[model samples]
Target chain A: MYKIAVDVMSGEKKAEELIKGALKALAEEKELELTLIGEYDIISQELAKTDFDSNRLKIEKADQIITMDESPVKALRKKKNSTVNVGAKLLRKKEVEAFISPGNTGSVMAAGLLKVGRVKGVLRPPIAIQFPAINGSTLILDNGANTNCSPENLEQFALMGQLYAEKVMKIDNPRIALLNIGEEKTKGNKLTKASYELLNNNPKIKNFIGNVEGRDIFSEKVDIIVTDGFVGNIVLKTTEGAASFFLELIKDSFKTNLLSKLAAFILKPYLKKSLDKIDYRQYGGAPLLGVKGLVVISHGSSDSTAIYNAIKAAKKSIEENMVELIKSEFAKNEELE
Target chain B: MYKIAVDVMSGEKKAEELIKGALKALAEEKELELTLIGEYDIISQELAKTDFDSNRLKIEKADQIITMDESPVKALRKKKNSTVNVGAKLLRKKEVEAFISPGNTGSVMAAGLLKVGRVKGVLRPPIAIQFPAINGSTLILDNGANTNCSPENLEQFALMGQLYAEKVMKIDNPRIALLNIGEEKTKGNKLTKASYELLNNNPKIKNFIGNVEGRDIFSEKVDIIVTDGFVGNIVLKTTEGAASFFLELIKDSFKTNLLSKLAAFILKPYLKKSLDKIDYRQYGGAPLLGVKGLVVISHGSSDSTAIYNAIKAAKKSIEENMVELIKSEFAKNEELE
Candidate 1:
C-alpha cells in the first residue's frame, strides 16, 4: 500500500471534515495507507463517528495547528509540530510516499521547501494545477510557489510541467508553451521574452509551441503552460472568479421567474454536470512540483469531495513514481546547459 | 457639437462596419460630429451606402493603413497618414475632442504619448477597462498600457481610475483598492507590496480599501481596482477567457440531449440577456487614462455593437472633462506625496 500523510488540522474546518474525507478515501481506495497528523483526541472522535479500515488508517499525532493568518515561514519555523510540518516529517522519514496540506499556501510552500526540501538540481519548486479547458484539462505550473522568478526558473518549470503532464496526466507527448500577452517570440514583458528564448532553444522541452495568449489557455491550444508564479496565480484566481460569476448569472436568470425556474429544473442535471467539470474542487488541488517528496496542496475551502479527489491524486502520483523520474531528469541536466 | 476623430481604417473590416457604426452613432446623437479618417474613396463609398446626416459626418483623406501584424511604433512613424496618426493630428490641433482607435494597441499608445502628448504632470497613462462584477461593473486600470510600473505609477492609476469611475461610470466616491495576491497589507510581489503602501497612504484616492485578492475583483468588493499594467492585462484576458469558457460549457450542456435542448429553448431569452450583461462590448472600450485628451481604445475584434458602445464611452468621457480632472489631480501630486 502507498503511504500518505494528510495534514487534517489544516484548512478552515480543522480535523473534522479532513478526517472524514480521509476516511472516505480509505473506504474507496483499499490499497492506501493514511497517517492522519492532527490532535489525537479530535482525530479519534471524528474517526469514531465514521467506520474506516483500522488496518490502513493511523494517527501521527500533531498538537500544533498553523493558522492561515500567521506568517507562513515564521509559523512553520516556530510551530515545528504543526500538522503541515509533522506531515512533512513523515514524508522525509520515508514513512509516507506523499504529503498533503490544505493550510496557508505560503506555509505549505515553506514546508515543502524548508522541511520537505527541493528535488536535486531544482531551482524553485512550482505548483502545477489542472485548468479545465474545452477539450480537456490543461496543466499550468509555477502557480504561486514563487512570486518572483528568473527566466531559467521558468524554463525549468516548462520542463517539469511537461513531464508531469506526460507522466501523471498521461498525455502522450504533451505540447509545452510559454504564457505571454502575445503569441510572438518577441512579445511580452522582460521575463517572458527572456524565458521564450530559453524555452525555444532548450532541447529538454521537445514540443515547445512558442508563446500562447490567455484566451487560448482554455481552448486546448497547449498541453502544458509555463509562466511565473505571479501570472499563474492571477490566472488561477481569475478563472475561479469568472466561472463563479457566470454560474451565478445563469442561476439567477433561471430563478427570476416561474417559467424559467421550471425550465431550470428540467436542465438541472445537465447544468450541474457541466458546471462540475470546471469546479476546482473536482480536480482536488495542485501538486508542488520539483519537491523531493510528493506534495499536494488542496484549496483552502476543499470539502469532502475535494479531499477525496486529492487523496486519489496522491495515489496516482505515487504509482507513477514521479519523484524518481524527476530526479533522473535533473541528474542529466548539468550537461545540457 | 463635440467633434470626434474616428479611425475608420482601424480594424480588419476596413471602413465597412466602422462607417456604418459611426453613421448609426451620429444618427442617434445629434450633438456629435465625426471626422472619419481613412482612404477617401472607401469612406465616401461606405458612407454613400447608408443614409446619414451630411452635416454631422465628414471625412479626412488618408492613404495609409496599419495592419495589425506590423510593428506598432515603426508603422506609426512610417505611415504618417495612417488613420490613427491622422486622428491624433486632429486631436492635437483641437479639431476633435476625442480620438478613438481600434488598431494596434502599441501604436495607439505610442501615438497618444508621442503625437497627442501626455498630460503635463502625468507619469504614465494607463488603459482602464470595466469588469462586469456580480453587483455591477468594476473599473480596472493600467490594462496593458505599461508592462513595468513603479509604486508611484500605480498611485497615479488609483486617482485616475477613481476619477474615471466617478465621472464616466457615474459612481460617486468610488472605493479604490490595490489588486494583490492576498488581502493582507504585506502579501504580494515587490511591485504589488510597494503599490499597496502607496495606495493605502494616499489621500487623493478618497475611498481606499486595503489590498484585495483576484477573486474579490469580480465580486461587489470594490468600485475600482488598480495594478501594474502587466497584471491588469493578464486579469483582463483571463476574465474574458474564463467567462467565454463557462458560457460555452453552459451552451454545450443545453444542446447535449433533446430534453435539455427543449429546456434551453424555453430559457433562451433569459440566457441571452444574462450573457449580454457580462459581454465587454456592451460596456464599450477602456479609456487610455492620464492622457492629455480623451482616447478610447477598443478591442481589435470590436464589431458594430462594440464600436457604437465605444463612441458612447468617448462621448461620456468628453462630457465629464475627465482629462482636465486628471491634470488637476496630478498638479497637487507633490503636496500629497
Candidate 2:
C-alpha cells in the first residue's frame, strides 16, 4: 500500500472536512493508506461520521495547529506537536511514503527541510504546480518556494520540472522553457538571460526551448516553464486575479436587465463546464520538488474535492518512484560534472 | 491649440488607418492640431480618403519607416528620417507639445531619450499604463521600460507614477503600492524589500501602502502599483493572455451545442459590453513618464479607435502640463535631497 500522511488540522478548512476527503480518497484508491495527523479526538469524531475502511487508515495524535498567518520557522519551533510537524515526523520516521499539507506554505517547507530533509545534491526544493494551459496544462515551477533564485536554481528547476512532466504528467520528451520578458536569448533580466545559457548548454535537458514570455505560459507551445519563485508567484496570483475578475465582470453583465438575465440562466451550465477545464482542484496540488521525500502542498482554502485529488496525486508520485528517480538523476549529474 | 506630433507610418495597422483615426480625433477636439510624420506620398494618399480640417492637420516629410522588429538603436542610426525619429524631432524642436506612436516601443523610448531628453533629475522614463482594476483602473509603472531596476529606481517610479496618477489621471492622493510576492513588509525579494523601506521612509509620498501581492493588483485596494519593468511586463502580458484565454474558452463552449449557441447569441452583446471595460484602447496609451516631453506609446495592434483615443490622451497630457508637473516634482525632490 502507498502510505501518505495528511496534516488534517492546519489548513483553512476544519479537521472534519480534510478527514472526510482523505476517507473518500482511501475508498477510491484501494492500494492507498493514510495516517491522519491531528488531535486524535477530532480525527476519531470526524471519522465516525463517514464510512471508511479501518484497515487502511490510522490517526496520529497532535495537540497544536499551525495557523496560516503564523511564521513558518517560529511556528515550527514553538508548536512541536502541531499537525504539520507531526505529519513531517511521520515522513521522517519512515512511517509514511509521502506527506501532504494545506497548511502555512512556509511552515510546510520549513518542516520538510528540518524533518524529511532535501534530496542529495539539491539546492532548493522548488514548488511545481500545473497551470491550466490551452493544450491541457503547463507545469510551472519555483512557484513561490525560492523568491530569489540563482541561474543555477532555475536550470535545476527546469531539470526537475521536465522529469516530473515526463514521469507524472505522462508527456514524452517534454519541452522546457525559461519564462522571461521576451522570446530572445538576451531578452530577460540578469537571472533569466544567464539561466537561458545554462539550460542551452546542459545536455541533460533534451528539449530546452530558448525562452517564452508571460503570454506564452498558457499557450500550447511549451510543456514546462521555469522561472524564479518571485516571477512565478506573481504569475500565479495575477492569473487568479484576472480570471476571477473577468468572471465577476461577466456575472455582473448578466444582471444588467431581463433579457441578459434569461440568457445567463440558460448559459450557466454550459459556461460552468468550460470554466471547469481551468479549475485548480483537477490538478490536485503542487509538488515540492527537490525534497528527499515526496511533499505536496495544497492551497490553504482547498475543499474536500481538492484534498481528495491531492491524496490521489501523492499515490501517483509514490507509485512512479518520483523522489528516487529525481535523487538518482541529480546524483548522476553530479558524477558527470 | 495643443500641437501633437503623430507617427503615422509604423505599427501593425496601415498608415491610412492611423491617419483616419487622427483625423477623427482632430474633428472631435476643435483646439487640437496634428503634425503627421511619415512618407509624404503615403500620408497624402491616405489623407485623401478621409475628410479632415486642413487648418488642423499638417504633413511632415519622412522617407523612412521603423518596422516593429528592428533594433531600436540600430534602426534609429540607419533610419534617421524614420517617422518615429521625425516625430521625436518635432517634439524636441518645440513644434509639438506631445508625440504619439504605435511603432517599436524601444525605438520610441530611444527617440524620446536621444531627441526630447529626460527631466533633469529623472533616472529613467518608466512606462505608466492604466490597468483595468475592480474599481475603475490602477496605474502601473515600469511596464518593460527598465529591465534590471535598483531599489532607488523603483522609488523614483513610484514617485513619477503617483504624479502621473494625480496630474494626468486626476486621482486624488493616489495610493501607491510596491508589488511583491506577499503583503507583509518583509515578504519580498531583495529589491522590493529595500524599496518598501525607501517608500515608507519618504515623507514626500502622501499615501504609500506597503506591499500588495499579485492577486490584490486588480482589486480596489490600491491606486498605483510599482514594480520593475520585468515583473510589470509579465503582469501586463499575463493579464492579456489569461483574459483572452478565458474568453476563447467561453466562446468555444458556446459552439459546443445548438442550444448553447442560441444562448450565446443572446448574451453576446451584454458580454461584449462588460468586456469592453477591459479594452486597451479606452485607456488611450501608456505615457512614457519622467521624460522632458509627453510621449504616448500606443499598442502596435491599435485600430483607428485606439489611435483616436491616444490623440485625445496626448491632448489631455498637454492641457494638464504633465511633463512640467513631473519635471518640477523631480526638481523639488532633488533639491530637498
Number of the top-ranking candidate, with TM-score as the measure: 2
TM-score of 2: 0.98
Residues A1-337, candidate 1: write the lDDT tens digits.
Answer: 9999888888887678787788888998989999988889988988887677899988989999888898998998899888888988888778999988888888888888888899889999999999998988989988888889999999989888888888888999999998887787887888988999999898878999998888777887889999888888888888878888888888888987999999999999998898787888878788998888998998888877788889998899899998988888888896565
DockQ of each: 0.73, 0.86
Poorest 10 consecutive residues by lDDT, candidate 1 chain B:
B328-337
lDDT of 1 by residue, B19-101 (tens): 77787889999899998888899888887776888988889988887788889899998998898888888888889989888
TM-score of each: 0.95, 0.98
Model 2 over residues A1-337: C-alpha lDDT tens digits? 9999888888888888888788899988999889988888888988887788899999889889888889899999999999888888888888999999999999998888888898888898899999998879999998999999999998899889988999899999999999988887979899988999999999989999899988887899999999999999999999999988998899988998999899888888988899987899888889999887888899998878889999998898898999999999899978977
In candidate 2, stretches whose alpha carbon ends up further than 4 angstroms from where it belongs are none
Docking class of predicted structure 1: medium
